[model samples]
Target: MTAPLILHYAPDNASLCVRLALEEMRLPYRAVLVDRAKGAQRLPAYLALNPNGLIPVLETPQGPLFETGAILLWLADTQGALMPAPHDPARAHALQWLIWLSNTLHPAQRMLFYPDQYTSGDTGALRATTRQRLITQFDLLENARYANWLDAVTPTAQACYLAPLLRWPALYGGPTDWFDLARWPRLSHFARRFEARPAARRAALAEGLGRTPFSAPTPCNPSEGSAI
Candidate 1:
């Protein structure tokens, strides 16, 4: 029998995206906690798997895969689900949004979460600016032509990836008063629908996310490991 994939993760981190996808696909995998409160990610042992010391590192037959987007894409392709097939015309649209989530929206959130990483001074101003940028990004996403995927009855990798991004702003980084899911009705609707899925419910339980994790997120009370 093929070895089950191993996912090194911390609760409520980007790894949650992968866990959601795994559950959606009903794949066999083991979850290993990385305790961020203990600085476990930066330790040499974890570094060997992901030199960047990121929260997630999936041990696959090919090798250890880091980066949440890459792992989600790999799972979609390998399992032949979650994303449009290679020859499908919709594949272009799917790839475009997936890359946007990884390169644009995710980094914008990171900047809001850790402004000090970008600037040594005036982190407050940095966060303030990032918050507005995130709003604009969300607005664009709300009206994107291909946004039908967000509410599809069958979950997609993009939906798995997006659900967590929608959740974090309300719970993490700086003041969340500026971030409201209801501001974008379409995205808000997507959140409510996505979180009700069996896959989402299972991932939420595993990570200690509340029942309405995506639509009405609360700070995680993970059974193990720290979210920070």
Candidate 2:
């Protein structure tokens, strides 16, 4: 039988999601890093596993899984917790939050923030359009803070990824930090509460990062050329 081995880039968004769940279960696994700066992820060996050349690929006895949402969901299903207790309202609720994170939250923020990182063309204009999507998603979540989406019993997987992004200054530095959490005190409160978990702390440290994930560059909107 193959041990669960995860191939990921430390600072990538999807890697964070798996790290959180892996810690929560205290599962024994190995982390093989793909340092993007050196272009390791695009190497043929890595591409053989995931032709898309994306990070956060999990190689298991069952094969490989990609994408943050699927990776976390696969973990939860194996454990049978944090995903509602079958036929419960929370089952549908948990799925909804996961879908929102997959379809809206992650993509919108990536587009707004990582445009130049991916393309040489004007990312600023695309970021402007994506920013609106992020704000709307944030507002929608705020509108229903009490909806129990963040409950420990079924803590939506969204937090496993989003909280770290919010806290990492390298990712959201400067004036934007004010807007990132100011209007979302409830969400921030929830994030703080979640981050305090032992599992969460372990996940943060497991990447062997000497500093917080926020230490990276914050790109300008794509309208301008790449930040660096």
Q: Whose TM-score is greatest here?
A: 1
| Off by more than 4 A, model 1 | none
Give the alpha carbon lDDT tens digit for every residue of 1-228 in model 1: 167899999999999999999999999999999989999999999999999998789999998999999999999999999999999999998999899999999999999998999999999999999999999999999988976797688899999899999999999887899988999999999999999999999999999999999999998989998899
Best candidate per lDDT, number?
Answer: 1
Residue 4 accuracy (lDDT) in model 1 = 87
TM-score of candidate 2 against the unseen true structure = 0.79
Clashing pairs in 2: 123-222, 124-221, 124-222, 124-223, 168-214, 170-214
Measured by TM-score, how close is model 1 to the native structure?
A: 0.98
